[model samples]
Target: MRSTSSFFHFLIQKCNRKTRRKLKFSKELLVVDSTKIIVGIGQLPWAPLKGTRAGVKLNVAFHPSVGQPHRVIQSTGNHHDFRSSEELFDAAIINVADRAYAKCKRFDEYV
Candidate 1:
């Protein structure tokens, strides 16, 4: 398995380059969401909250036009979906998301 730091750095570099190349402003909208994955890293002493497991979160940003991902930000399972929205939106030319990401503040900011 790769170390956490190295994996994140690789992901950032890969995603940044791909985002710059693939994302185009053609009146196309993008979608943002997250998924949870179990990492099984054992228990930690300083956990964030109750009922949270040791896992990873996949924060995905994709354009609806071509159905391809533009940006992907990975974080701990405990990280909330909203926490990565700003970065995802900023990277996207147009942003679309599920009801789970329908926060008034984010919607207003995007507008």
Candidate 2:
């Protein structure tokens, strides 16, 4: 936990040092998005939002270059982004997110 910055730096540095197998263009940066799954109110009563509304959300950040998931978070749908967002990286690896995330309170820190 204390070495978050160093860990991120080391990852980027290692990625940069990897040997390229062929002549092509690739993005080393990452992209992020969120999705939701609706669950029956009876199954997930803790996330209730009136009537039968209840669900959970998944936030993911992935590396475009290697097609690998770099970070992920899951939380009750009622809590929203602010409550579920975790620090994905310490390096500013050109994260591309939608405008909704751009306006979030903790979005600036990642960049």
Best by TM-score: 2
lDDT of 2 at 11: 59
RMSD of each: 9.2, 10.8
Candidate 2 Cα misplacement greater than 4 A, ranges? 1-27, 82-86, 104-111
Off by over 4 Å in 1: 1-26, 43-52
lDDT of 2 by residue, 1-111 (tens): 748547554554444424323323253566666778787899989887658878888877877566578898887876565443446532556565655454555556546
TM-score for each model? 0.57, 0.61
Model 2: residue 65 alpha-carbon error in angstroms: 1.1
